[model samples]
Target: MTLLSVDNLSKSFGGLMAVNDVTFEVESGSIVGLIGPNGAGKTTVFNLITGNYQPNTGTVLFDGQNLVGLPTHTIVEKGIARTFQTIRLFQNMTVLENVLAGAHCRMRAGCIAAMLRTPAQRREEEEAMRQAMGELEFVGLGKEWQNKAKNLSYGNQRLLEIARALATKPKLIVLDEPAGGMNDQETQELITLIRAIQDRGITVLLIEHDMGLVMRVCSSLVVLEHGAKIASGTPAEIQSNPRVIEAYLGADSE
Candidate 1:
């Protein structure tokens, strides 16, 4: 049950290769981690998968369809939603408004329908509002629906990004460095939220440097170094892998 299959994916900026012939598969209903030290091209691989960048070689298949040249919005429409390594939120927008923006892809109302206040458009708007609130509640921000995005604490801001992505109704959500700026308590909460997401039957593929969080949540892991995949396996296997230790995890991983 592979939901995503990335084969021989490579991307280069000028002469420098950001990602090189990396291949990985994310199974449906599993939480997968992409790990490495900074500059290992983990985020670059994410960009390639989500259609922000086109790979120079190879194919990205989501549900058996190629996504190499699709626009980013089209990729989202195809059931793949992503968050940035840096939290990308509409800071000035209300929490609910931010989530509603993510629902735009699934919305069918055109400008004419919206302007004319057609019955179909009204129903769609109501449904989007309902979905947005549900996602906010799922992420523990239900009470803050009217708060501006910038008003949330740093960790909650991250959760808000996840909620927004969820509003897209994606089969797979790509999270880039989701635990980048969180304290221990917040990270623990994040671990719970991630598992809850999997419980909903959605697959998650994340780039995270937080090894503890990665180990706790992910059933499988792919390690990268120097823009290529070095090793991939279960947490226990990756923890004991010598090459992974030497490349990124270091001697203290044990």
Candidate 2:
């Protein structure tokens, strides 16, 4: 089943086209990789999907609802959550506090209810805390819940970001360059975490340059170059695709 359908999507910045007529679908309960070399517009496609940028043409359908003009928070409420290419944790905030922030979208208490300490608000707050802690534990940061986000090691910081995104209770999570700054061990752990996320029945869509990681985790891939989709298929098919090879390696390479 298609949880997300992006059709005829195109975006441009002034005169330069960042993404052009790209399309792909993310099936429910699958890990899909959107991959390309730098400047190939992989992130642009992500931005379009998550409502950060409006495309000049095309439609983004999430569970059959169009997401194009919706605000970012609305999109989150509609079950799509995303992380940035650069880690976007609240550095000064406690790790638990950071996760709680992600849960804010699902929270229903208004300022009046919160200020008055209504019974409903209290119950919601308790539930939010419980959910936040669970996400932290799931990402292996349960013991560091009280530490400031900046105190975590670089790789642990990445896990914290994922934990926070999970707190949103999204059906689909969009991860941008999730393995960008990790060592081999950290990357391996990430592979496991990603699989665990899929195991929990959340669809994962990611933009990653780490080919090995992409091949290992993604059931299918969408390849891009020069702001357009060049090819998309299983890992084995992409590996044998001459166009994908030429895009990553120079055409002159033997």
Candidate 3:
């Protein structure tokens, strides 16, 4: 059931090691949390997995294929997709249009087909629109489908990013700090949306600092420090893990 595996992954810039010999597997249909304090190499791990940065040492295997040399878009085409720590959307495009852009990867109609208005192209376009609406609704943006991306509230903008990522039809979706900078109510709502994403049978690999939210949503947890995994387990076990507590949070401060 392992959809993705990271074996001895390490990355360095100049002489600084950002990620060091990290290894983990993302099981199919599970929500896995990668948690650590800032600069703990959490986002660096994500970039390595998603092919934004090729590791100096190690391999990323997706469905048994080596993904280390693949480009980002190629990796995405292999059923892996991700969102950023900062929400990245086409600010000038409508919500639906942004979602449709994600669908562009899977579209079969070429420029000629689109320009000629072939029946197959027309059907593909219609299906993409339908799927785009479904994605918007899935992320609770159904009402704002026609609005420009910049017009929505900050929380809704985050939801739009999730919807757009989902449009890629990835089997494994990596979210980097999906709840960053949200209010309490918005975080709660995001917690629910994340669970809904899991319920639909896609595996989620999340990088987050909000321990409370991580414990609530993730079925498994991985804690990292100075680029290496310090501890990993169920939320209860992680909360009590002496290493994680001392390394990430103050041992004296709960």
Candidate 4:
């Protein structure tokens, strides 16, 4: 079953075409990798799908609904969420607070209800906190739930972002270069956590430069070059594809 579908999606920034006729689908519970060289429009594809940039052409269907012009928050509310290439966190906020913030879109209590401090609102708040804590525990950040987001290590900060995104209860989560600057050990742990996220039955579509982690966790791989898709297949197929090697690892790496 397809949870998210990108059909002939294209985006442009003035004269440069950031993403051109890129298309891919993420199955309901599979982890799909979007990979490429630095200028390959990998992240551009993500932006178009998530509504950060409205596509000049093509369609984005999430759960069979057209998501073309929806705002980022609305898209997220429709069961798709994403983390940025850079860590976007509330630096001064507590870890629990960060996750709880993600839950805001799902909460039913209105501003009036919050201001009134109604019993119903109180119940809803408690439930939100419970869900946030569960996400934190899932990401191995339970012990630091009360700590400030600024206080955690960089790797832990990445995990915290995932925990926050999980708190949104998304059917599909998009991660951008999740293991970008991690050491080998941190990357290993991140790989395990990503698998755990997939095991929980949520679909994952990630843009990653770390091919090892991509091969380890993603059941499907989509390669991009110069803002267009160059390859799409399983990990082994991608590894052996001469074009991917020549475009990504360079012709000499083969």
Candidate 5:
């Protein structure tokens, strides 16, 4: 099934057309890669899908609901969550607190219910915390729940962001440059973690520059250049495609 579909999506900022009439579908339970050069507008697509920008044209359908014009929080409520290219953790907050913050989207208790601490509200809050802890553990950070977000190693900090996104209980999680800075071991761990995320049946849309990791993690690839899609196929097909080679990898690269 196509869990998320972007049809004829386009976004413009003044004179810059960041993403132009790009369309793609991410099937449920697959790791789909969105790849291109530095200025290819990959992140712009992410912004558009997540409601950070209003598209000039086209539609974004998540589980069949139109996402354009929705607020970011409303988009999150619609079961689409994403992590930014840079780590966006609550630096001063505890590792667990950051995850709980993401869970706020799932909380039913309003300001009054929260202040009065109604029995039902307390139950809901407890469930949210429990889910947060589970998310931390799922990302191998269970033992550091009490630590501050800034205190974690760089790689763990990235994992914390993922854990926070998971706390929202999203059906589709979009990760932007997840392996941006990492050692070999850290990258390998990320590969495993991404596969594990897929195993949990959550659809993943990945924006990455690391072709090695993309090839290993993604079942399919979508190539974008100058805000338009050029080619899309399985990993092997993407690697050998002449246009992808000349446009992205450069003619001299393997």
Candidate 6:
């Protein structure tokens, strides 16, 4: 099933057309990669889908609902969540607290209940902590639950970001440059984690520059150049695509 669709999406900043007539759909339980050279409008498309920016033109449908005018938190509550190209975590908070914050949408304890510390509210808070810990385990960070998010190694911090996003209970997850700055071994671990995520029935929309990671993890890919789609296909097809080669790989011999 197509869980999300973008038709003829366009965005501009002043005179620069950042994303022009770009379109794609993400099927339920599938991984779709969006790739491009620098300034190819990949992240811009992500922002549009997540309601960070209003599209200049076109439609964005998430779970058959138009996402154009919805606020960011509303979009998240609708079962979409995303991580940034740069890791955004609460540096001062414990790893578990960050994940608990992601679970805010599902929390049932209101202000009065929380302030009163009623039995029901206490149970709700305990359940939220349990759920957050489960998410931490899912991302292989359960042991770091008490540590400050900023104190972890860079790789662990990235994984923590994914864990926190997962805590939001999204049906679809968008990852931006997930493997960026990782060494070969770390990338291998990332490949495994990404597959595990997809296996859990959450559709993944990936924006990545590491061709290696993209080829290994993505079942399908959309290549963009100057805000327009230039090519899209399986990894094998993308490898042979002349337009992708010219736009992303240039004249350098393969």
Best by lDDT: 1
TM-scores of the models, in the order given: 0.99, 0.97, 0.97, 0.97, 0.97, 0.96
Error of 6 at 40 (Å): 0.7
Tens digit of per-residue lDDT, candidate 1, span 130-159: 999999999999999999999999999999
> RMSD of each candidate?
0.7, 1.7, 1.1, 1.2, 1.1, 1.3
lDDT of 3 by residue, 189-220 (tens): 99999999888998999998877789889999
Evaluate model 4: give its TM-score. Answer: 0.97
Q: Per-residue lDDT tens digits of candidate 4, residues 155-254?
A: 8898899998999999899999999778899999999888888888889999898777888899999999899999999998888899899889655542
Tens digits of per-residue lDDT for model 6, 1-254: 89999999999999999999998888899999999999999999999999999999999998899999999999999999898898999999999999998987777779999899999998988988999999999988999999999998888888888988898899999999988877888889999999999998999999988888888899999999999999888987988888888889555524
Superposed by TM-score, candidate 4 places the C-alpha of residue 125 at a distance from the truth, in angstroms, of 0.4
Candidate lDDT (C-alpha), each: 0.95, 0.92, 0.90, 0.90, 0.93, 0.91
Top-TM-score structure, candidate number? 1
Candidate 5 accuracy as TM-score: 0.97
The stretch of ten residues in a row with the least summed lDDT in candidate 6 is: 245-254
Query: Which 10 consecutive positions of candidate 4 have the poorest summed lDDT?
Result: 245-254
Candidate 1: misplaced stretches above 4 Å?
none
The reply for model 2, stretches above 4 Å from the true place, is 249-254
The digit string of per-residue lDDT tens for model 2 on 1-254 reads: 99999999999999988998999999999999998889999998989999989999999999999999999999999888888898998999999999999998899999999999999999999999999999999999999999999999988888988988999999999999888898999999999999999999999999998888998999999999989999999988888889988887345433
Colliding pairs, model 6 = none
RMSD of 1: 0.7
